[model samples]
Target: MTSSPAAPGSRLASRLGFSDRVFIGRAARRVADQIEAGLDLVENGLAEDLRVADSVADAASRYLYEAGGKRIRPVLALLTAQLGEGNIPAVIDIAKALEMTHLGSLYHDDVMDGADRRRGVPAAHAVWGNSVAILTGDILFSRASQLMSRYGDRAIRLQADTFERLVMGQLHETVGAQPGDDPIEFYINVLADKTGSLIAAATQGGAIFSNAPAEYVEPLRLYGEKVGVAFQLLDDVIDLSAKPEETGKVPGTDLRAGVPTMPYLLLKTETDAASAALAVQIDEGVARIADGEDPAILDQPLAELRDHVVTQKTLELARTWTRDAIDALAPLPKGTVREALTRFAESLADRSS
Candidate 1:
């Protein structure tokens, strides 16, 4: 197995934990040189794309990128690109564009969620105000499109489709489930659209832009989408499980914001008196937080919910989706890339981030 260049138990290594990081190292070791090169290319290219003549716009656009991230999306793009010639110029450009799209969405998400911190720092909106943050997000989106444009009509179409899904997901979240809608199904679809679409694009872009086989495209897309859903589902659990120091945010941040998560949704499905009472408390807690009250007020009920049977159910379901993501890769040729993709999917489900 290939060892990570990161020092053991360092912030980067700890991000995935020792064993989980081992899985990733093993998968990508064969293509380690390419992965490292692709990562550097993405980092440099992303910074350049964020730069603009307007100093404010330039600074705003680079905010989240500068804060640093797991770089999951770009890394996935680079990994899949290995199925072809590996780290081609087009693949690097695609990776940079996709990362920009992701960073742009986070700015808008923080504003909508009223989040105070991101990546352990004040959220963009908190620092720059909502208008500036929103406009900055728009600027990144436009910049991503400009990058996509170089790859011709096909890439442009993919970008447009992914953007639409992202907007629709956010809109659906804002409007919430209609009276008769199944909340669980609706939530899953939202996860798919909001988190899954861009990941799907990243995987598909890697293969397509790298000139990998056309047949590999659909399977990779499916894999990417499922991995995205699994990733979000894991985040749902992590929202409840992680310590603030580990995640760079307080536990139950989403729950306090009245955002539906798998655990809460599962808890809602119960009819037992204890579950019913806790759900009510959860709803009340969300309302209090929405009114600008502290989330710590709900610590007792949040702890109860975190330890509930339904929360375990949510975790099990996340693992199921992660497995399905791996299954989706069955059509791909078996090699280092496929193994790495499988490891990556499993690692995502297992992560605190």
Candidate 2:
């Protein structure tokens, strides 16, 4: 794994994070190289983890796993590990299992969202139908649990807790806000449970496995949750702005699928006449989009919404959450681990994709 910095754009370095700056000169080369190498092992180990006895089962389980992803969870786990022992074998194992959990979630998510594409390819459900796709997700989750079991109770308890949160997150989204529940608050809570919980586990698990100071664990967990919320909030913005080529998602994919996003959700809160008028347009537009109306028909509303105050508010909220994430790192000692994570959070906030 001693892939020293020979090329700036080497394959190993390219795999580290969404930002090109992640494994470059931002952190010490030795530490960056070590994490990059550990991630490579995680990637290979993931493929082996997905391997099954029946060829059909193998192909089904490996479909989404084979398709490329950002590997954000694994990268985060490895990055936090730099705080303590620096990507020990235990940390690598945690990274692998977390990634498996993430991949499995994507399979079911695509089925639910009716998403045709993921990671630049047809989603597993599109390729193999929903039943097989769901079963593949189950297989991946089962394997993830089996792998975590190897680490004994500490790991198993963490796995069980994370799994519960993830399910609750999805459940809340599906059932939506209850009476007396604030819509925005409910939405953010769903983001925390759905997206934030596993990310929190990744950072927390890194500290646990790498023998980092106990005090670092909670702060890192907080950082991970805020980062996850910020990531999804920005994704809400990108859903309206980014092209399919840029994000591997059609512009308005979430709206077209009847999924609620921040910009539209924020519009629902306005009481002023123009804002109220635009809110109706957005609701109607989303309904039309869900009914298979031509996307071009909604371009006017989309453009207006893109430049609207609510959209700007969504971006502002994302930045706020991102700042909170950085603030959570105050407990961490000032060093390479903190710097790398700080830059990592900054890059995610600013990413276009």
Report the number of the highest-lDDT candidate.
1
Which stretches in model 1 have alpha-carbon errors above 4 Å? 1-28
After superposition, which runs of candidate 2 have C-alpha atoms over 4 Å from their true positions? 1-12, 15-27, 242-245
Tens-digit lDDT track for model 1 on 243-347? 878765578878887888999999989999999999999899888877988878889898898889987888888889889999999999988788878877777
Q: Count the backbone clashes (under 3 Å) in each candidate.
A: 0, 0
Instruction: Give lDDT tens digits, candidate 2, residues 1-353.
Output: 11222334433455534344644464566667676787778877887878899987899887776666667788788878988897777888889889889988999888887877887688888889999899999998899898888888999998999999998999999999999999999999999999999999998898888999999999999999999999899989988884668676667767766788999889888888988887787678877866888766666777777778998899999999999999999989987678778878888777643
Q: What would the TM-scores of all predictions be?
A: 0.92, 0.93
Q: Which residue pairs show collisions in model 1?
A: none
Model 2, global lDDT: 0.82
Taken over the whole model, the C-alpha lDDT of each candidate is 0.84, 0.82
